[model samples]
Target: MKLLRLVLPGLTMIAVTYGLARFSFGLLLPDIKESLGMSEAVSGIISSLFYFAYCVMIVLSTVITTREGPRRMILLAGASAFLGLLVMAVTPNVWVLAVGVFLAGASTGLASPPYGAAISLWMSRAEQGKGNTWINSGTSFGIALSGAGAILLSPYWRVTYGIYAVLALLALLWNFRVIPRAEKRWKVTFEKGNLSLKGIKGANSLITASLILGISTAAFWTFSRSFIEIAGDYRSWELSGFWVVIGIFGVLGGFSGSLIEKYGLAFAYKLGSLSIASASILISIAPEKWLVSFASAGLFGGAYIFLTGVLLVWGIRVFIKNASLGIGIPFLLLAVGQVIGSSLAGLFIGAWGYAPAFILYGFIGIAAVFIGPKKNKAED
Candidate 1:
């Protein structure tokens, strides 16, 4: 019962911030580009802003959540999402749109670390991992909702974003009512936030793995739908259906906690990376094929969420003393990599095409597998 109370609202919050605010842009990008007269290069540069904002906010959120407690950061996250979505709904120019995207992305950065801190403070040790993974799966739910919205709203993307804004506002209120009050305040200090080299010992593998995965997955998140649309000439319904499939399968990632507990983090991590990498390669082979494309979306969505869940637990264990930093550091690196990857993928696609770009990214994901987690009994 207690778990449900936290996980439900937490999940909703994540869905709103990540799924609606951060990722829905990708699903809507084709329309947005058509409306705004954007080139692929311009779109990719704008998309990279999302990760750039995330990179900035994650560090700040980690430090603030560590010092002031989770409640404030959580509320701030919801507010950021609400405002960002509203801006997206009304943007008149690409610059305005970029501002909206940055705000929305910042919400995701703000949303994650506080939840890690919250779970640490409110939930028992046995339930913390479960709480983290379940809440993380909210991204999938949000994505599914956005896809459904895209199907129904079709070319009326402003209306879609407007509706999403209202939903974000509602989610913000829901979280405000549900998230626990800050119980205590810690003295703010540089060391307390765990940003030091000493704080990151034995975490080299986690850092490397997350950075690489971020780069590998950026193409899928930013351009996979565009690839399929161009290659297959898919109808509106089919394209949205592809997104819905990704979200539906991504719900499986909520079970990542169980997978990690049963099989161990190393095993689960490797499995997820392999599956995600394979998704990229598989789609590159025949993105025009309905089965192949949809399968790739499902594989990417499921494995992406599952791998992040594992990283969440892995980060928490590595920085056990500071839960916010545990979530922040890995996520920050992920965003950093994405910031680099989004622009590069855009250039690569323009230079070569989707297939080669995706294949190259797939090899990168496989490389991440070689930098596996160390044998840590405490984490196990």
Candidate 2:
């Protein structure tokens, strides 16, 4: 019961911020483009705004949450989501839509770090990893919900976004009721010379791997549905179903902490990286085939969330002193990678097309495997 209060709202907040607010842009891009007369290149540039906003807010949230406690930051995140979704619902032009995307993306950045801190503050140490991963999986739930909305509201994207805004508001209200006021503020002092590279293990590998994975996954998150719709000439239901499959399979990622507890982070990291990379290559092979596309979506969803879960644990362990920083660092770098990858993906798809672009990203993921955490003998 104690854990339920935090985890439930935690998950929902993440779902609203990440799934609906951030990734859903890709799922709905084709329609949005048709409505706004936007090109793929322009769409990609706008999508990059999501990450840029996220990057700024996450850094600020990490610092603020550390000093002020999680309550205000969490509420701020919810508020951002609500406003962003509302803006998106009414957006008439590309500029207004970009503002909405920026705000929505900012919500995700505000959402993540504080939750990490909240888990550290509220849950027992033993329960922190499980709680964090469960909350992280909320992205899958939000994605699935958005996919369902797409099915029911096909070609009525404005209505779909309006409904999502109401949902975000509801989530915000729920969190406001549940989240407690600030307790003890965490103290972080760089001037004390307490933080150093030698003290934090795995920081380098974690940041590098996260950035690479971010770049590798950006093509999919930003353009996979478009690929399927255009390349496969999939119907509305089929495309929506593909997005749903990704979310449903992504729930499997919630178990990543357990996987690490049993098989260790090294194993989880390697397996997840390979699986996600394979997903990109797999879809490229036969996106026109429904089975292949859905399978690839499932694989990507599961693997992407799973890898993030692994990173959450890895980041927490690396920055054991500051849990918010633990969550902030890897995620911040991931957004940085997305910022770069989103832009490059647009150009690549424009120049070389989807297949070659996706294949190239897959190779990037493969390269990430070499830079992963060293296998711990004790955990192995």
TM-scores, in order shown?
Answer: 0.93, 0.92
Cα lDDT, all candidates: 0.87, 0.87
List of clashing residue pairs for candidate 2: none
Q: Output the number of the TM-score-best candidate.
A: 1
| RMSD per model, one decimal | 2.8, 3.0
Where model 2 places Cα greater than 4 Å from the true spot, the runs are 36-42, 184-199, 377-380
In model 2, the worst 10-residue window by lDDT is 186-195
How many clashes does the backbone of model 1 have?
0
lDDT of 1 by residue, 1-380 (tens): 27889999999999999889987887788899999999988987888778778888998999898887788999999999999999989999999998899999899999999998888887877898899999999999998888898888868889989998898889889988887676543332122444564646657877888899889888887779889999997888999999988888898999999988888988988898898899989999999999999999999989988888988999988888888888998888888777677779989999999999999999989988888776579666
RMSD of 2: 3.0
lDDT of 2 by residue, 1-380 (tens): 26678899999999999989887877677789999999877986887788789999998898888777788989999999999989988998999999999999999999998888788877777787889999999999998988998888868888888888998999999999988776533332211112345757678888899999999998898789889888887888988899999999999999998898888889899999999999999999998999999999999999999999988988888787778888889999888887788779989999999999999999999999998878775223
